[model samples]
Target chain A: MNLKIEKVAIDGVLVRMPYNPAFCADEDKTLLHGGVLTALLDSVFGLANFVAIDGISSMATLDLRVDYLRPAKSRADVMVRAECIRQTRHIAFNSGRIWFDEPDQAEVARGAASFALTRGEVSIFDAMTQSRSSK
Target chain B: MTPDLATQQLRKVPFFQFLDFTITELAETHAAATMPFAERLIGNPIMEYYHGGIIASFMEAVAAISVSHGPDLQPPKPINLTVDYLRPAVKGALMAEATVTRKGKRMASVRTACWQDDDSRPVAEGLYHFLLV
Candidate 1:
């Protein structure tokens, strides 16, 4: 998934994912599969956790729950807002919502997740950013 | 529908085509599929692990097929889902099986599991609910 971070801060993040025909459900490419929304939320949640929580070695998703409120029908880009609500010594909690980029901005899905964290001297964020920049 | 026939039908779905899975087993209340690993499916760039969402998505696809297939042209409405990640999936073909737990006039519940090698050591398990109306 080619993701664009439109906005990011300690509180949360706003991401935009363009609609790709490959992820569409029907032959007409009118509606997107719910799985794409799930995948998008999963990715955004990771970003949120990386930004919100300070210092860690690694993180892994423990579980995720998503509710599909409506059919993901639209040709416009999809916007996702995610935040890490709480953090513990070895765990992180996240919540997020998704919508189309249209004016109405109708919500398509809502999701929550928890991640198992390993705290260390080096942060996963720095590692990832370094590897990304190096490449 | 026969597995071969179901595979043909699935090709029409763009997302399924993108996932590039083949229907291996199809029953009245169960469905199974296999998806080969691809570059785009990797979530952890450094570790090269299969994205947790892709595993959930694959299971959801199989679950939907288990719930709605045959004469129904309209797909089942996805209401909600919960997924538990048990292990990281390495770069290899993934298999998923979906079993319909309960089906009512207005709703249906499905359970799904995905694995790369041994079925006992699953990568993930999911519970999905769909609106049948």
Candidate 2:
């Protein structure tokens, strides 16, 4: 199972996927493992900021809301599309969609998220400045 | 919606801090350490594939990450996590990507998706909302 970063479009954004049998979590339903999904979503979003953000920065996902739209039926191929929709001085925003095939579009899910981008080191604010940081 | 201490407290749990616990990284910056796919992590009833519930947990984790990405904002505890199983995840290393769609004083909304072997077809999709306590 070699899952490499496939595409990193404009603005340093990164995209990738896994192609193997271990990516599966369940064998009966042919459904994917939850951890795998988490990995995919996390990678793309992290890459999104890694592309745009400057300096040695860090972010904590305060909230992650997900709504599953439909079931992915394909067994051979799967895809996830993500893009940065907005970026503020303090935070970076992005959105993404998943599809199994074309025409049908057959959307598997849609997501929108926010990540806090900051300069300086992580411990400085987490350790020293308590209320000075801007989110 | 600001989350209560309980929600914020979930981040302190060590069980939530494993590499396989990819979503846990959403609790804080710095990508997850490892991708642990233990046998117990496998899903049931899905047959030959993985279960969507496990995937849902990961989605929930990402949603948590999106809501709590900001340093100024304390990561919101998951008040509601709804997931729609799109398809079976591939049997291998899988990854997910998510970003904030909207953030308010009391609520945060985000989106995420699961990619398997093929970055073209998503194994699952999710829309998440966090209630600020």
Query: How well is each residue in B6-111 modelled by candidate 1, as lDDT tens digits?
Result: 8899899999998999999999999999999999898886788998899989999999999988855578989999999999999999999999999999999999
User: How high is the CA lDDT of each candidate model?
Assistant: 0.92, 0.52
How high is each candidate's TM-score?
Answer: 0.96, 0.44
**B2-85: candidate 2 lDDT, tens digit per residue:** 223323444443224432444334433222212345554443212334444456666666566556654355545444454445
Docking class of 2: incorrect
Best by DockQ: 1
lDDT of model 2 at position B44:
26
Instruction: Please give the lDDT score for candidate 1.
Output: 0.92
Q: Residue A103 deviation, candidate 2, in Å?
A: 7.3
